[model samples]
Target: MSSSDIEFSSSDYAVQLDLIGRVNGLTAAKNFFSSLRDQDKTVKTYGALLNCYVRVGLIDESLSLMKKMKEMGFLSSPLNYNNLMCLYTHRGQFEKVPDVLLEMKTNGVSPDKFSYKICINSYGARADYDIMEKVLQEMDSQRDIQMDWCTYSLAANYYIKAGLKEKALHYLKECEKKVGNDAEGYDHLISFYARLGNKDDLKRLWDLQKSKCRKQTNKNYIVMLGSLVKLGELEETEKLIDEWELSCKTYDFRVPNVLLIGYCQKDLVEKAEAKLQDIIKRRKIAIPNSWSIVATGYMNKNKMEKAFECFKEALAIQTQNRGWKPKAGLISSILSWLGENGEVEDAEAFVKLLRTKVPVNREMYHALLKAYIRNGKEVEGLLVSMKDDKIDENRDTMKILSLQDQNSEVTG
Candidate 1:
């Protein structure tokens, strides 16, 4: 995706395997590349296999395959060097990177801008500005190769990571000048200006990019709005959200409740109360994480009652969509909060509900015991069950007994 779309070829079965692995995952890629090797062993094969393994995060395998490539007389080409540098650079493995560069230079393979980008990144990672500057000087002499956007964009990024904001800004402008009004350059400028906290420049760059592209429609606005919100620029985020409502289709989209309402994450009670209308009006998010965010926000605000309700709502939504029980664990903390807040009756109700939902979950079992303890009745019998260490019986008969007792207490 970084480079231009490669034309599909039979010789590139390994490259295809690598791409598939990157998209799917390392394990999937390994399985795929191995299958390609099995397809034909006599030909020039594993160069792509090595590249794929590198891409899919099989760094050791990629390296081992590099040695194997030499053994099999697959002479190291520019693509081979490029892929190797990419592997080390992407992984931030600096010591390994120089060894590859040394190999390239020894073999009289002239390194290019992208190759130096890896070296700059390696030095940037260690904050070694001296060597980084040396690499930049060396790069200055290689400008006749016609450095592309990727070249200086990487330089800008490297400087930014090195905490040299001025240098980053300079290189970024140089990148723009090289491209002469490219759309992606504008996008990079927007990101860099945002990073620098130059809100005016950021907005200006965004506007320019937006104008060049399609007419700032709903989907595009959503993407931009998310990027702004994630940057923690609350005022800018609000401005974009309001702008979207004015110009674009609202559709069924809604921002995260906490982001929309400025809800304090640790104050779940107040967060839920503040966004209560949004919570109801915005169709529920199937992500358990969103529910947890609201729930935590309410709890931090000591809004225990609202927090409990939010978690329960999230549990139901999560169960329906994903059949995932990950969030059921939150009930333990919620039940604890309920008991602490003297909401004994609510805790008992939840225990009754849990029995009807997941009968054998440990959290439900604990809630049932806690509810009985709250009422000051039949704690002795449950303690006896605990003492017997009848773990499986606890999973079944004892849980049922506690549920029935809680139900009787609640109903009566």
Candidate 2:
């Protein structure tokens, strides 16, 4: 457009600034804003830059830019103020959020639904129910403001957190009235009812959602499955999984993972493993975390051999699921078990696989030494590797070495 002599509109510049921030980061955004002509620095462009600052969490820069925007009469809309309030909320400066709302009102800017919601949330977060109620009342009394399900649902959530069951139910009823065939609203209400352990309501809303909404999304299934798991309704969870599997066009392991996790939490790890095995037998895709979940459950039950088997299953297909690493404590426990009772070859293979995931550490060396000593294998090569890894001998290392020496004496 510049080459064609087309002038850059203010909206264009604003959009370009946002894109720069997202694609090239804050420094590039700043450079672009700085390079803009003075006339091009309209309210939209300036607000865009402010959004960039807030998005990146540059608190001081956001405030300074906000001040500059106000000085230049660019603070007419409530958007910039809302951005600041959101920033403060994300930063956990809940106390400062209401003040921003007050400032917006005092500046003669009409607060939007979002502005009121943010303030209500701030008060709720601080657990100031009285003030939260007052803010809700104030928002309700606004002649221009039309209350929505989100505000009511948000209030219900905080009420649930506060253990005000009656109030929570009341607000949830209000939220349901406003839901009016919206899937997301139903999802929130379902989750809240689950939190309250109201299974009847959970089933009711889910049924209603399935009938009213034309298509159930994966997210909806995930939420419902998670809710059932939370309520310990494993039987119902299984039925729902079957329902989802039949209808779902694409398979998502997360749907069953909810049940897998539920099984583990309830100490029914064998059931979880069975379910995973069934999925595997059907040639379905399962992530490492799925196996790891079962492994963790077995570990809790002191079934180290079963845990080791599950852990190996997870490690075998780990490359298929990037960014997944076994928990360090889990690995340590497995290593200790292998050193005491596992084959030397098995320990060596496990440690070799472990090196790709985590750095060389004292725990790895110790596990290998113990396995070698127990198998009556030579320790010279292992000691050289440990020294080359620069892991200095500690008390535990010395103890393991002492054991190796005693084993040698016995052999000699």
Best by TM-score: 2
lDDT of 2 by residue, 1-412 (tens): 5578878899999999999999999999999999999999999999999999889877899999988998999999889999999999989899999999999989889998899999999999999998998988999999999999999998999999999999999999999999988999999999999999999999999999999999999899999999999999999999999999889998877778889999999999999999999987875768888999999999999999999999988887788688897898799899999989999999999889878777989898898899999998988898899999998888988999899778889989
Tens digits of per-residue lDDT, candidate 1, 1-412, equal 3276855454666556657766887677667656653445423456656666666566777778777776776645556777887887777777677678778788777887677778777777777777877877787788555666666777777787667889988877777667555665666666766666666767766777676665655544544555565466666766766666566544333444425434453223453345554545664344444566666666656667766887666655655445444344455567666644534567766666554445445454455565665555565665565556444444544654556567677878
lDDT for each of the candidates?
0.62, 0.92
Off by over 4 Å in 2: 1-6, 22-25, 283-285, 323-325, 356-362, 383-399, 409-412
What shift in Å separates residue 258 of candidate 1 from its native position after superposition?
A: 7.4
Global fold similarity of model 2 (TM-score): 0.90
The 10-residue segment of model 2 with minimum total lDDT is 279-288
